[model samples]
Target: MTTEDSARLAWFKSTYSGNEGGACLELATTPNAVHVRDSKKPTRAQIVFTRQSWAAFAGFTGRPR
Candidate 1:
């Protein structure tokens, strides 16, 4: 998506993020894709994932590879 499209998303930070300047991420979801970016740098490029791919990744992460 274009910058304009991304600007329209309602981004949400992960609940796991703390205020101590540790690793933080934000996510915004649409019917077609999931947008991910560093919470500290909202203007940076994002990693977009398809619904199926994101679902698989969400399920696989923090688990044994």
Candidate 2:
């Protein structure tokens, strides 16, 4: 599999991410993968997740059932 460039990663902060930068986690989603990275280290190693796995993880963010 080919890894993507940090610069090319289109990072999107959560709506909770205010100007204070307390919530700095960034996410990037591609055709078959989702990426999670620290906004503080946008140029460093990023966590990769398969589309299916990401869907599960993202679902948890909605509510703790």
Candidate 3:
């Protein structure tokens, strides 16, 4: 998506993210995909993932190491 397209997305930070300004990320989701970007540098590059791919990643990360 273009910068303008992404700008219109309803981005929100992860609930786990703290307010202390450490590492943090924001995410925006659509029916088909998910968008992720650094909360501190929203204007920079962002990574987009298919919903299935994102769900797989989230499932893996949710598992115990």
| Residue range with the least summed lDDT across 10 consecutive positions in model 1 | 56-65
Alpha-carbon lDDT, every model? 0.89, 0.78, 0.92
What digit string (tens of lDDT, one per residue) describes model 3 on residues 1-45? 788988999999988899999999899999889999999889899
Task: Give the local distance difference test score of model 2.
Answer: 0.78
Worst 10 residues of 2 by lDDT: 1-10
lDDT (C-alpha) at residue 53 in model 1: 96
Per-candidate TM-score against the hidden true structure: 0.81, 0.72, 0.86
TM-score of 3: 0.86
Ranking by TM-score: 3, 1, 2
lDDT, residue 37, candidate 2: 80
Among these predictions, the greatest lDDT belongs to 3
lDDT winner between 1 and 3, please give it: 3
lDDT, model 3:
0.92
The TM-score measured for candidate 2 stands at 0.72
Colliding pairs, model 2: none
Off by over 4 Å in 3: 61-65
Query: Model 1: runs farther than 4 Å from truth?
Result: 61-65
